[model samples]
Target: MTLRPISEDDIQALVDERLDTARRSEVEAYLAANPDARTRVDRLRTLGRDLRTAFAPIATEPVPAQLNLAHIVEARRRPRLQVSAWQAAAAAILLALGGLGGWGLHGTLAPAGVDALAQEASANFAVYAPDRTRPVELAASDSAELARWFSARLDRKVGVPDLRSADCRLMGGRLVATPHGPAGLLMYDDHRGTRFVVLMRPMAEPGDAPMREHRFGSATGYAWAQDGLGYSLVGAADPAVLHPLANTIRRTTATNT
Candidate 1:
């Protein structure tokens, strides 16, 4: 019997475990013959699994009392008889607080240099990590092309880090914009399905900087600068475990540059 051609979406579905049972065997057979696609699917599965594990706690948390619908409606109707100046002020304050809460998510306020790099990596991880279908535009088998892509976009000689020694396989990468400029975001995963990201962008000025660990809500990342480039490796893992992995990236990047 003739079989249907496998598309990128099919591979994504296989990795996400969302492929139809009838097509599951067919896709497995195809991946068995295609090493690159097989590898990409494995890493993507890891990324999705890790994303769920990391965000499950936050997903289960109850909504804050201040954000409760009943509370807001009650407050609005509390002064039906006559809205006093203090009541009006309180309403305005609640609105102001809501706006302030979102400022960080929108990157309206961020730290300078390395911290910003880490924060951006963490933020990007939150976005792409959860996306099982299209976490990245390019796959790890295209590392050479990925390297050239990042190099041209950043206007620097950027190279893809080889994390095989660290047991973190490169899944893929895509270009992400930062307040500073365009940044390259690479995703990776380990055997245990632990996923992480590495973000690199050219610094405004060239100077060596010490490695710093940053925690962005539930995400943890390590950021540093060497030569003229800034790099951040972020994941949902703890700082101690990620420390060595970040070092591995540092050495790989240094050698590649």
Candidate 2:
């Protein structure tokens, strides 16, 4: 039988492995003649392998029974004051020492929220990144399809800008939950290791004015908001390596919007 032209739905179905033997063979033959489609197939295959390996260990673990009943009664109980007297005394001493500069002292002592975000991004990157086969929900080779898949899941349009011209290649993207809402995790790699950028719609009130730069451990981050979207770029790379990519992303997003 002669092969039919591949539609977007057909490609998706093939990726989902819904095709029968004959149709699968037809698609394989078609992919043999199309390099881009072949690359996409290979990438998806890799992702399947990675996902299997990443999740296989969980299947063998036993579930605990007491974990459910112990928490059920606690939910209906009244709130308890758990603060110790010693803890309150220490807080009083600190407040007295801080005196009129308490606000400044608090600012200096408080953990930076941006740093927390960067650390979470990096830890997630490290865990999910080893899957060279399927590191993202949408591969770079399938930008349009990925955009469609992610946009629908996130309830907003998502775009993947090509940075290969700037010597960076798309590593893939994953869906992650954030305090604001569900966020898209798009990663890229250059000569060094992986760099991550998170895309999401802005929260009703992000609390403070816009923060441009944040440093956490060895990672650095940049955040900005425009056109009802929030963009955050984080990586262990220096400002020199990241600045250009940040500019490229900002420019591309700005132009397209």
Candidate 3:
């Protein structure tokens, strides 16, 4: 039987991980064959993750005083005073998704320097690794174009690192905002769908530094710097397997400059 052409709804369902097993397999095959479609799927997946991450915390926080049942009832019973448009908007927002489902994130500051790079990479991994439909902003079939777009964003020539020796296929890349600045994110996946990410950004404080291992959440990876660009390789892969792979990326990117 012939499967219908992949549509936006299909892409969304893929990101949401709601597609049936057989149709999902077909969709994955289609994404692999079409770089542009895969990119769009990745983007849609990323946007969904960003929303959930942003709002999930807010959704968990205790109801504010204004939103409390007793307070709401009391306010309603009191004489209805004229409310400014701003106050009405704020109340509406509080009663809506922005107020109940998200908006709790406000206190923690992002890590600085190389630490930030590793954090960003790990965060990106968390955001993308589980996505089977589209995990990269660009598909490997368009690596050359992805390279150009990445370099343009960084204002430096950034070459996509070859990870074939590691049995990891280039899944393409995207530009991600970082504490330092905009950075390039290159993703790779192996035969088992094991995903690894390489994050590169221009260093501000210490442009050159030795490699050091780091851990963020469940991800174990290494971060280092050369010249003025900082790099972090992050994944849930075993440390023993990642160390040498990180070294290989270092050597390859070293020559790229």
Candidate 4:
């Protein structure tokens, strides 16, 4: 019997472990013959695992009383006979307090260059990490093309760093718009199935730290500046896990540039 040619969706399904018994075997056979597809599939599986691990604590934590939507709706349904001026003022004060409380729930209130980059990188990681189907706009097979495209878009010579030495394999990358201009985002995953992202943009100031660690909420990252370019390695993994990867990326990027 002739086996059908595998599509991108099939590879994604394999990564997600959604394929059936027969299909799984077929995909495994196909991947065994295609080293590139096998590598991409491995990265996708790693990303899925990392995403689950990172968000698992939130899943197990009890919902905040203020954030319980059902309870809030039920409370709203209770009748208020009348709103006196004093009661109105008290209500307004409570509303402001609620807003402040919500703001404080997201950790790290300070503003700085590294902090801003870390926030953006973390946001991007949240968006793309769990998506095994299409996390990157460019394929790893076209690394050279992606390099030229991103360099032109950013008006600088930036190439994708080879992170295999750090046991993290590059899946692909995507281009995004930032306040400074175009930024490049590259995705990678390690052997243990932890996902990480690297974001690069043009630096605004001349003097910035070569490397800085940042943490906000459950996110941990490292941001740095070199050669007038700002770089960040962001993920939901712990700081200990990300620090070494950040160093590896820094050295690789410096050499590539």
Measured by lDDT, the strongest candidate is 1
TM-score of each: 0.59, 0.50, 0.57, 0.56
Q: How do the residues 1-257 of candidate 2 rate in per-residue lDDT, one tens digit apiece? A: 55588776766678889999888888878888999988988898789889999999898788566556666567534333234555687677556434312123343543334433443454445545556667677777777776776688767677777777778788778777643456677878876656565544444444433537766557667765556566677777788877777777777777764
Candidate of highest TM-score: 1
Model 3 CA deviation exceeding 4 Å by range:
1-109
lDDT (tens digit, per residue) of candidate 3 on 146-223: 889978988888888998987889988888775456888889888998889898888886568888898765678799
Residue 108, candidate 3: Cα error in Å is: 7.2
Count of clashing residue pairs in every prediction: 0, 3, 0, 0
Better of 1 and 2 by lDDT: 1
- Please give, for residues 1-257, the per-residue lDDT of candidate 1 as tens digits: 99999889898888878888989999999999999988988899889999999989997899899989998998888776366767787666545433322226452434678976777787788888878899989999899999999999999899999999888899999998776778999999889878899999988779878899988777788999999799999899988889999999999888889
Residue 47's lDDT in candidate 2: 92
Residue clash pairs of candidate 4: none
**On residues 139-173, what C-alpha lDDT tens digit does candidate 4 reach at each position?**
78888988898899889899899988878888889
Name model 4 segments beyond 4 Å from true. 1-112
Off by over 4 Å in 1: 1-109
Model 3, TM vs. native: 0.57
Deviation in Å, model 1, residue 172 alpha carbon: 0.8
